[model samples]
Structures are given as structure tokens and as C-alpha cells.
Target: MRAALGLYLELHAHPELSGAETGTAERFAGHLEGDGATVTRGIGGHGVVGVLRNGPGPTLLVRAELDALPITERTGLAYASTVPGTMHACGHDLHLASAAGAFALLAAEPDTWNGTLLVVGQPAEETLEGADAMLADGLYERFGTPDTVLAQHTAPLPAGTLAHGRGPMMAASAALDVVIHGRGGHAGTPQLTVDPVVTAAATVMRLQTVVSRETAPSDQVVLTVGSLRAGSRGNVVPDEAELSITVRAATDQALERAVEAATRIVRAECAASGCPEDPDVTLVSRSPALLPDPAATAAVRAAHEREFGRHRVLDWPGSMATEDFPRFAVGGVRTAYWMVGTTSPRQWRAAHSAARPVPPNHSAEFAPDVRTALPAGIAAMATAVRQLFKETW
Candidate 1:
């Protein structure tokens, strides 16, 4: 736990963005090597896979993220992010640290459990690309296929708590990059120019209907225009406007419908504005909803209940947050994903008392109660792995 805390602090301070986790990977691989695991680097863009074979048994893979978000830190911690515009707001640092700590525990007591341990530090999880990249690069072919893959994510709930979902664990997501082209003319000549910025603005408004009007009220769907880039100055109208839209839903069908409706809205808005060219709508990335295997999840949930008690462990009412971790479930590998709470007791009470929202994952103020959360997370992961080991594959 102490070692994990140190690594957590170091990782939290020097976070790297998605696809640029070179130094982060080096540090993580180094730590894994220190724990006497055969660490392999450069699997799929800074992805680290450390193989620890402990006799012959069912192979278990524990995965954690290596990259952080692009948000700047505002958590006001002593070990706050040193890199500007990069922060571990998503508790990935905690996840990585817990994986490292759990692997270390397993290594120290090798006699307690059988089989191999595959610890993966995946990169580009923030952009939902790392898992696919690793799989495409032969994650399973290179490393032997595992009987089970286990992972946990941090949530805004009070620290020392674990949440498990019986069915759907997370939402499916699709991100699209759109470009609207318009005829550029003098800004003063409103008659000659077809302004793309106007089209983009209109498209943004119409996109809201994809959820409010089109999607079922019972369904959870979120459509966000995260980025909109247009002209540089007010004087000159740019030839094209760009938009980055991310659509997330509880089901794949809803996600597809929302994305289709969004793209249609963009094209209609561009056409309505009499734009000179057809709009370009490109799929940036997409991830299916995370549905953990029932048997696998049951084993891990029981392990966590034994480790953290029934009160601290609760049923997760599924969330809309999406993850690429599901990609690792390819090739008949059963997977289980759960949530570990991160908010401190004081933070929880204060937020509840004040009736204000606590800073969530991806927020600049998103800081986990690492001292409490990290240890619990490490125990949860280790216990889950150990319990899975005793089960028949």
C-alpha cells in the first residue's frame, strides 16, 4: 500500500495525455519489473504488459489505464499535476497504482494463488482507442489467452465503497468529427458568403432534439458538442467549420440512432445555410457498452463483499460513462468490471450538507481520496483475483 501510494502520487503529478504516455509507461513498466514481473513494453502505443507466471492454473488478466485526461489540475493538492493542461482527473492513477499494488501482493504470496497474472497498463483510454489498438496488435495472440479479464474504475461515491452491476455496466459511445464547408467571402458582404459558423451554430441547436425529442425518455442518451472550431477572427469568415460530437447511450441501438440523427442534423443545417460543399462527418472512435459476465462478476462481487463487507459493497445502477475496456473481452475472454468509490468521507458529508455537486471524473477538481481509496482498491483487486483463481474455468 505504501509503495502504491508513492507511485500514485508520482503518477498524479506527472500525468501524460492519451497516445503520449511514453514517460508514464516507462515508470509503470519499471515498477512492474521491480515487482519481479516480466514486463513488456510497446505493445500498442505505450501499452505495457507484465506477465507473472506462478505455476499452472487459470490465467487471470488485470487491466488498468495508463493515460490521463487533457484537463488542467485545480485540485490544490501538493502533488497536483505538474504538466499543464494534463490531469489524472479520472482516477486512472489510482487504478494503475492499485493494479501494481495488487500484483505486488500476489507476487509476495505466490503460494496463495495459482496461475499466471497478466497486468496490462493500457494507453489512450481517454480517447477510447487503447484497448482496440492493443487487441489489433495481438494482445491475446502474443500473450496467451486469459480465462478472465478483471478491471475497476473509480467513481464519485464515498471512498472505501465498491459498486457492481448485474448486467449493463457502462454505456456505448460514438465520437464523430464533422467539417462543414462554406464559401468564404468578405465578412462585410453577407450576400456573397455562406457562413459555416452559422450552420454549425444551427446544427448544435438541432442536435439537442436527438435526445429531447427523438430518443425515448426512459433511455439514457447524451449528445455533446465538445469542440467547435470556426474562424480565427471576427473580420474574416473561415472556409470551413469543424465540430467534434460525442454521443453516448445505454444501448448500442440508441447510440446508433443518436449518432445518425446528429449527422443528419449537421448535413441539413449545412444545406439549409446553402453551403457550397457537403459536410464531412467522420467516425473518430466508438466503444460498445460494457456488460460484464454474470458468473465472473458474481465471483468478484462476492470477493469484494468479503473484503469490504456488504455495507461498503452495493449494487451499481449502471452508468452512462463509456469505456474501451470492453475491447479486451474479445476472443471468448470473460471479463468483469466494477466501480470503486473515491470521494473522501469529509468531502462526501460536505457535498451532501451543502447540496452541491462533488467534483466528478474529468473535472479539474477531481481528486480521489487516495490514502483510503488506493488501499481499498488494491485489496479489492487482489481479493477478486485470488477468488477467481479458486474457481473452475
Candidate 2:
């Protein structure tokens, strides 16, 4: 536990961005090596795979992310992010530490369970590219396919609790990159310039109607204009405006409709502005909704009931958060994903009494209470794996 906490502090202090996790990969791989795992590096971009085989039985794979968000840290903790513009605000550092601790516990008690344990440190999860990259790089072909794949994420609930979804767990999402073109000219000559900056701002405002007016209220959809960049100086109008959008929906049909509406809005806004050319809308990445296997989920849920009392185990209604984990479910592979509580009891009480929400993932103020969450995550994971080995299916 002490070693795991130390590693957690180190990772939190120095977090790497997606697709640029070389040093992070080295540290994770080195820890796996210390635990006697046969380590493999660079499966995808900076992905690390550790293998521990003890007499052949069922193979179980545990996944933990290795990348951090681009947000700067605002948590005044002593081990807050050292980087000026990067922080592990999403609790991936905690995820990695818990995974490492679980492996260590299992490795020390080899006689208690028998099988192959594959601890995966997957990179680039934030950009929704790591899982696909690993699959394209022959992840399953090189490493033996496991009978069950397990992963857990952190949430703002009280620590020492776990949540499992009965059916759907996460949303299907897509990323769209748009570039709006216009005629650039001096700010004084407003009549001569098309002013893409104005068009971009107008389009952003108009896009809100896609959800509030266009889509059904019952059908969940989230469209966020995450990035928008235009002119360099206030005195000049830029030639082009770029916007990056992310759309997430409960179903594939809803997702398609939302994307189409967004595209239509952008093109119409450009046409109305009389820009030089049609706007460019490119699909960056798309991932289907994450629906965990029913039987596998049940097995893990039961394991959680045993590890942490039934009162601590709750049913997750579902979330709109997007993940690329469904990409690994190709070819009929059984996978289970759950949520672990990261908030301390005091934090929960304060939020409830104040009628305010706790800081969420990707927030600069978000930080997991390691003293309580770390041990629970480790036990929940190790016990889940041990239970899966004992299940019939």
C-alpha cells in the first residue's frame, strides 16, 4: 500500500498528455516488472502490458488508463500536478496505483488463485484512440485473449463503495473537427471582410438548438464546443475559424441525428455569411455505446458484494461519459466495467449539506482521497478477479 501511494503521488505530480506518455509508460512498466510481470511496451502508443502466469487456468485482463487531461491543477494538495498546464484530474493516477497494488497483493498470494493475470496500462484513453491503436497493433493476436476483461473508473460518490450498471453503462460518442473559411481583411474594412470569427461565434450559438429544439427530450444528447480558435489580433480578421465538437448520445441513431444537425448548422451558417468556401467537417473518432456483458457483470457485482458489504454496492443508473473500451469487445469478448467511489465521507457530506455538486472528472479542482479510495479499489479489483476465476461462466 505504501509503495502504491508513493507511485500514485509521483504520477499525479507529473502527468503526461494523450499520445505522449513515454515517460509515464516507463514508470508503469518498471512497477510491473518489480512485481515479477513479464512486461511489454509500446503495444500501441506508449501502452504497457504485464503478464503473470501461474499454472494455466482462465485468463483475466485488468485495464487502467495512463494519460492525463490538459487542464491545470487547482487542488492545493501537496502532491498536486507540477506541470503548469497538465494534470491528472480524471483519477487515472489513482486507477494505475490501485491496479498496481492489486497485482502486488495477488502476486504475493499465488496459492490463493490460479490463472494468467494481464495488467494493462492503456494510453491515450482521453482522445479515444488508445484502445483502437492497441487492437490495430495486434493486442489480442500477440497476447492470449482473456476469458474475461475487467475495468473500473472513479466517480464522485463516497469512497469504499462500488456501482454496477444493469445494462448500458456509457454513451456512444463522436468527435468532429470543423474549419470555417472566410475572406480575411483589416478590421477597419468591415464591409470587405467576411469575418469568419463572427460566423464561428454565431454558429456556436446556433448549435444549441440542435438539442433543445431538434432532438427528443427523452433521448439523451450532449454537444460541447470544446475548442474554437479564430483571429490572432483584434485589429485583423482571420481567414479561417476552427472548431472542435464532441457529441455523445445514448444510442447510435441519436448520435447520427445529432451529428447531422451539427453539420447542417455549420454549413448553413457559413452559407449565410457568404464565406469563400464550404466549411470542412471531419470525423476524428467514433466509439459505440459501452454495454457490459450481463453474465460477466453479474459475476463481478457479486464479487463486490462480498468484498465490500451489500450496503456499499449500489446499482449504477448509467452515465453519459464516453470511453473507447467497447472497441475491445469485438469478436465476442466478454468485458465488465464498473465505477469506484473516490470522494471521502467528509466531501460527500459537505456537498450534500451545501446542495452543491462535487468537482467532477476533468475539473482542475478534482482530486481523489487516496487514504480511503485506494485500498477499496485495490480490494474490489483483486477480489473481482479472484471471483471471476471461481465462476462457472
Candidate 3:
């Protein structure tokens, strides 16, 4: 556990942003090979797959994300981020370390399970494009698709608790970028300009209605305008304004309706405000929602109860967070996404600041209490892998 913590901290100190995780992938590959697993590098940009086969019955794949956020570091720790503009604000460092630790434990005790293990270091999860790239590059066909897929994400729950949900563990996420165009002029002579800033603001307010009035109350839809940019000066009216949005929904139908409603609102608002021709609403990227398999959840729950006792495993609500791991479900494989808690009371208090907002996963100040979280994560993944292989084949 100390060795795992040391490795995790080292990864936390030297963080890499999405799509630029060359060094991180190489280091993980080295560790995997050191543990007697056959390591494959450069699968999907910077993905590393470690194979450990022992007279396989069914192949079990365990995945861990390996990219950090683009926020500047402010943690002020001794092993702080060396990179200026990137940090492991999302606990991917712990995810990588825990997966490696689980691989180590399983490699040492291969006789405990009777199948192959594929521990994968996936990249570009922050951008939600890595898994697609891996699959396109033959992740499944090249290395024999697994019978079941297992992955875990750390959360803000208690230090040593494991949380699991049966179905719809995470919502699907789509990045919506709306560009509102209009004529520009001086702020004082507002009659001459169309003022896209006002139109953009109105559109932002109207977007809120998509989830509230458009979707059903139980649909679980989230439409957030994360960023809005328009004017550069107080006196001058900008020609165009842009809004970056994140749309989430529990089901695909709800997601489609949200997108359609948002597009209609943007068009209607631009026309009603008498702006230029029309507003451009485009989807930047998208990831499908993760729906957990009942059998997989039951297997994980039983395994958690056996390994950490029934008291440690707890029922959890579905998270609004998005994951691309659901793509694996397309080929008829069961998936389980677990939440490992990383927050402490001190950390929670620090997170309440309005100025800093307690540094969530994408913030540079976001850091996990690895010493308490890594072991449980490792144990959970290992137990899931063992149980999944044993029950299926």
C-alpha cells in the first residue's frame, strides 16, 4: 500500500493533460511489465494494455483513465504538479495506481482466478474521445473482447466506503457549442447594432427551460451553459457571442429531445431578437450513458460484501457524471462502474469557498486522499475481476 501511494503521488506530481500522456503511459507500461504481464504500448494514442493469461475461461478487462485536467496547480504540496498548466485534478493518478496494484495482486495470485486479465490505461477521458479511439483501433478484435468489463471512479464519499448502483450509473454527456452572430457598433449607439451579447444571454436563460419544461420530471436531464464569451470592451458591442454548454440525460431519447429543444430555442431567440441570419448550434462531442448490468452489479456487490464485509458496501444513487466506458456495452458485455470515495471532512470544508469552490475533479487544486482510498479501490477491482471470471466461466 505504501508503494502504491508513493507511485500515485509521483503520478500526481508529474501530471499530463489529455491527449499528451506519452510519459504517463510509458511509466504505466513499465510497471505492468515489471509485474510479469505482457505489456502492449501505443494501442490508442497513449493507451497501454497489460495481458495476464492463465488458461483462460473468460477474459476480464479492467480499465483506468490516465489523463489530467487543463487547470493550473494550486495545491501547494511538496509533490505538486511540475507542469505549469496541467494537474491530476480528477484522481486519475489514484485510478492508475490502484489498477496497477490490483494487477500486481492478481498477477501474484493468478491461481485464484481461472481466466485472462487485461488491465488497460486509457487516455483522453477528459475530452471523452479515448475509448472511441481505442475501439476504432481494434482494442476488442485485436486482443479478444472480454466477457465482462470492470472500472471504478473515485468520488467524494467517506474514506473507506465503496458505493455501487445497479442501473444507469452515469448519464450521457454532449458538448454543445452555440455561436450567435449579429451586427456590431458602439455601446452608446445601441440602435445601430444587433447586440449578440444580449441575444446570447437570452439564449442562455432560455436553455435552462429545456430540462425544466421540455423534459419529463423523471427523465433526469441536465443542460448547463458552462462558458459564455462575447465582448472585449465595455464601450464596444461585440459582433458575435459564443456559449459552450454541457448537456446530460439518462436516456438517449431524452438527450435527443434536449438537443432539439436547445437548437429550436437558439434559433427562435436569434430570430425574435432580429440578429443576423441564424445562430449556429453544433455538438462538439458526445458520450453514451453507462447502464450497469444487473448480474454484474450483483456479482460486484456479493464480492464486495465478501472481501470488505457487508457493512462497507453501500447502495448509491446514479451520478450525473459521464463516462465513455458504456461503449463496451455495445458488444454484449456487462459493465460495472464503481465509486471509490476520496474526500475527507477537512477537504470538504476547503471546497466550500466561493472563490475556489473546493477544487472539483477538473480543478488544479483537486487532490485525492490517496493513502486512504487506493487500497479499497485496488481490492474492489481485484475482487470484481475474480468473481466475474469465476461465475461466468
Candidate 4:
């Protein structure tokens, strides 16, 4: 546990932004090679894949994301990030530690299973590009296309519980960037200027209607305007206004409908506001929903029950958060993604404060309670991987 915590803290102190995990990859690769696993580095722009094949019968792929948010660090911990404008607020440090711990455990007892294990350190999950890069770089073709894939994410749930869902564990997400252009003018001339700020505000309000009125009531959809920037000065009417939106849906059809509705709403709102030109809506990032296979989920649950007792296993409702791990599932392999609790009561209360604003994932203050959560995550993932190899291989 001390060693795991040390690794987590070291990673926390040296957080890297998306697609810039060179040092992180090298550190994990050294550990993997030390444990007798065949390590491959620089596969997908800093992704490291470790293969442990012992007369394989079936292959199992385990993955952990290795990217940090772009927020500045403010946790004030002794091992807080040293980088000026980067932090591992999403607990990726813990994720990597648990992954390495699991690998170490398996390496110490390789005779327990008769198969191949692929441990992947994926980069750029926040930007939703790492999984695509891995696949394009022959992750499946080269690693023998896993029969089952298992991955776990640290969550803010109760400290000892392991949360898993059978189907559609997370929602599909798409980032929308809308740019509205208008004619700029001085504060004194109100009649001649087209106020893009007002137009952008109206567009933001109209975007809410896409989820409420355009989509069906039963369809789970979320349309959020996370950012809006218009003018440089208080009195001047800016020439352009920018709006960033995040859209979530449960299914592909629903996601497509939401995207179409958002495009229509932005165009209509821009026309109604009498903007000189139509707004440009672009998708910055996108990820599909995670649909877990029932058999694979049951196997993982059984492993949790055996290793940590039945009371520790939990059934959770589907989350609206999105993960790129589901892309591996799309390749015809069974996938079960679990949530490992990482928040304590004290941290939860502090995180919810409105004044100081402890932002969740992208916030600088979003540090997981690593001292208590890292070991449980490691044990759960290790037990799941061992059981998967036993059953499949």
C-alpha cells in the first residue's frame, strides 16, 4: 500500500495534459518490463502496451487512462502538481497505480492462469482520441484481439464498494463548439451594431429546448452550455461570440438526433438574432456509450464477491459520463467497466462548496483520497483480471 501510494503521489506531482504522457508512459513501461512482461512503447502517441503471454489459450485486455486535466493545481497537498497549468484532478494517477499494482500481482503469480494478458496505458482519454489511436495502430490486430476486456475507473462512491452495471454503463458524449458572427460597433451606436453577445445568449437558451422539446421524454439526453465568450469590453459589441456545448445521449440514434437538433437550433437562433452570417457548429470530441456484456459482467461480479465478499459488490444505475473504453467493446469482445470509490465524507463536503468551487473532474482541486482508495481499486481489478483469465483461457 505504501508503494502504491508513493507511485500515485509521484504521478500526481508530475501530471501531464492530454496526449503528452511521455514520462508517464516511460515510468509504467519500466515497471512492466521489471515484472517480466514484454513491453511496447510509443504505439499510439505515448500509449504503452504490455503483453504477458504464458502459453496463451485466450487473451484478456485491461486498460487504464493516463491523462490529466488542463486545470491548475490548487489541492495544496504535499505532492500536488508542480506543473503550472495541469493537474490530475480526475484520479488518473490512482488509475495508473492500480493498474501497475495489478500487473505486479499477476506477475508474481503467473502460474495461476494459462492465457495472455494485455495491459494498456491509454493516453488522451479526456480529448477522446487515445482509443482511436490505439486501434489505428493495430492494437487488436497485433495483440491477438482480446476475448474479453476489463477496465475500472475510480469514482466518488462509497470507499469500499465496487459499482458495476450490466448494460449502457455510460452515455455517449459529443463536444459542440458554436461560433456566432456579427457586426461590431461602439457603445454609443446601438442602432447600427448587431450584438453577438445577446445573440449567443439567446442561442444558449434555445439549445435547452433541443433536449426538452425536440427529444422524447423517455430518451436520456443532456445538453449543456459550459462556456460562453463574446466581447472584450463591457460597452463594445463584439464581432463574434463563441459558445461551447457538451451533449450526452444513451444511444447512437439519440446522439445523432441530439447533434442534428443542436445544429438546427444554432442556425435558427442565429437567423432570428439577425446575425450577418450563420454560426459554425463543430464537434471537438465524441465517444460512444458503454454497453457491457451480461456474461462478462457476471464473471466480474463473481470475482468481486469471492475476493472482497458479497457485500462489497454493488449494482449501480447507468451514468451519463462517457468513456472511450467502449470502443474496444465495439470490436466484438466482452467488456465490463467498474467504478472504484475514491471520495471520503470530508472531501465530498469540501468539494461541494459553492464559494471556493471545488470543480469535479476538470478542476484543480479535484484530487482523489488516494491513501484509502488505491489498494481497493488494485485488488478489485486484479481479482477481476485473474478470474477472467481463468474462465476464458
Q: Which one wins on TM-score? A: 1
In model 3, where is the ten-residue run with the lowest total lDDT? 351-360
Q: Residue pairs in steric clash, candidate 1?
A: none
Q: What C-alpha lDDT values do all the predictions have?
A: 0.92, 0.91, 0.86, 0.85
Q: Residues 1-393, candidate 2, lDDT per residue (tens digit)?
A: 998888899999999999999888888888889989999999998999999998868888899999999998998999998988999988999999989999999999998788888999999999999999998998888898888888999998788899999978999999999999999999999899999999999999999999999999999999999999998999998999999999999898999999999999999999999998999999999999989999989888988898788999998988899999888887878898999999987777878899989888888989888999899889989998888877733
Off by over 4 Å in 2: none
Candidate 4: pairs in clash: none
What order do you get sorting by lDDT, best first? 1, 2, 3, 4
Clashing pairs in 3: 351-358
Per-residue lDDT over 242-298 for candidate 4, one digit per residue giving the tens place of the 0 to 100 score: 999999999878998999989898898889888898888899988888888888889
Off by over 4 Å in 3: 345-360, 363-365
Q: Quote the lDDT for 379 in model 4.
A: 94
The C-alpha RMSD in Å for every predicted model, in order, reads 1.1, 1.5, 2.4, 2.5
What lDDT does candidate 2 reach at residue 111? 86
Clashing pairs in 2: none
Error of 3 at 124 (Å): 0.8
Clashes of each: 0, 0, 1, 0
At residue 171, what lDDT does model 3 achieve?
Answer: 92
What overall lDDT, based on C-alpha atoms, would model 2 receive against the true structure?
A: 0.91
Model 4 spans > 4 angstroms off: 345-363
